[model samples]
Target: MTSHPVRPVADLFAADGRLKAIPRRPARREALLAHLAETLFEAGRTYREAEVNEALTSVHEDFPALRRYLVVGGFLARTKDGAAYRRQQRPTGTGGAIPAVA
Candidate 1:
């Protein structure tokens, strides 16, 4: 598959890692959210819903939306009962750069 090009996260987020605004382009949005997901979660680890929310809250005030973006962007996996969450082994994203924000 030809990977979609992505702009730097600075083009999307504020200095604090909060999304300044959602990108209109799907490719850029997915790339930016996928980068955000990796920063908030770790490989080989699982999280409870509350834990995921707490972590996402540090990055954005609208944690639920952020969580949905992460899952929908194929960067995170969640259980059907919504009890568990984890970074997926292989995100079906365009494989873009990880953001530099903390």
Candidate 2:
């Protein structure tokens, strides 16, 4: 199986592990959103808006933007009423390894 390229998280965070700032580049921002979604939430667990805010704020002060990005990036799904959120499953690659070429 081929593995996906992992985005580097080292430069995006400070010594305390808080994000230095929300990334302006789309790729970088998407990586950040995925990291936040995976680390801050559990799959199949529903979180209220306040709970999400609290978890996000522990890492960065701008919780709203992070929340919006997570939803927009399809990393986190929200209820129609905007009352709850869940972490979507990480996308998988191809089911099996490719055969080696001679």
Candidate 3:
């Protein structure tokens, strides 16, 4: 029988010595909008288009389009001044923002 060589323990350690797994969740449009709305509302501040884009940058680089989609989808409401958007409080009977994609 032939024997295989074994690797040393030191060789198995990565530079950081930590194994990292990427998150499996595919950031959905609706979830992103809901999270943004909740964060802004909790902060008691309105978010401008640029601010919204910046807020979502870590999740997706195409945040401008995503923001527009959220606006069109009714997850967020554009202010009358057209300078910012606000998270619309869901209707009393409504459950929550519908999931857009998995």
Q: After superposition, how far is residue 65 of candidate 2 from its true place, in Å?
A: 0.4
lDDT of 2 by residue, 1-102 (tens): 656565697688999989899988776887788788888899888888899999999889999988887776677777777888888764544232221111
Lowest-lDDT window of 10 residues in candidate 3?
18-27
For each candidate, what TM-score against the reference?
A: 0.74, 0.79, 0.47
Q: How should the candidates be ordered by lDDT, best one leading? A: 2, 1, 3
Score residue 48 of candidate 2 by CA lDDT. 88
TM-score of 1: 0.74
Model 2 weakest 10-residue run by lDDT: 93-102
- Model 2, stretches more than 4 Å misplaced? 1-7, 90-102
Clashing pairs in 3: none
Q: Give the higher-TM-score candidate: 1 or 3.
A: 1
Q: Which residue segments of model 1 deviate by more than 4 Å?
A: 1-5, 91-102
- Candidate 2 lDDT (Cα, whole model)? 0.78
After aligning candidate 1 to the native by TM-score, how far in Å is the CA of 55 from where it should be?
1.4
Error of 1 at 77 (Å): 0.7
- Candidate-wise lDDT, in order: 0.73, 0.78, 0.51
Q: Model 3, 1-102: lDDT tens per residue? A: 555354333332246642122212323334445555565444445667677777655445566765665666556667655577666664433344432211
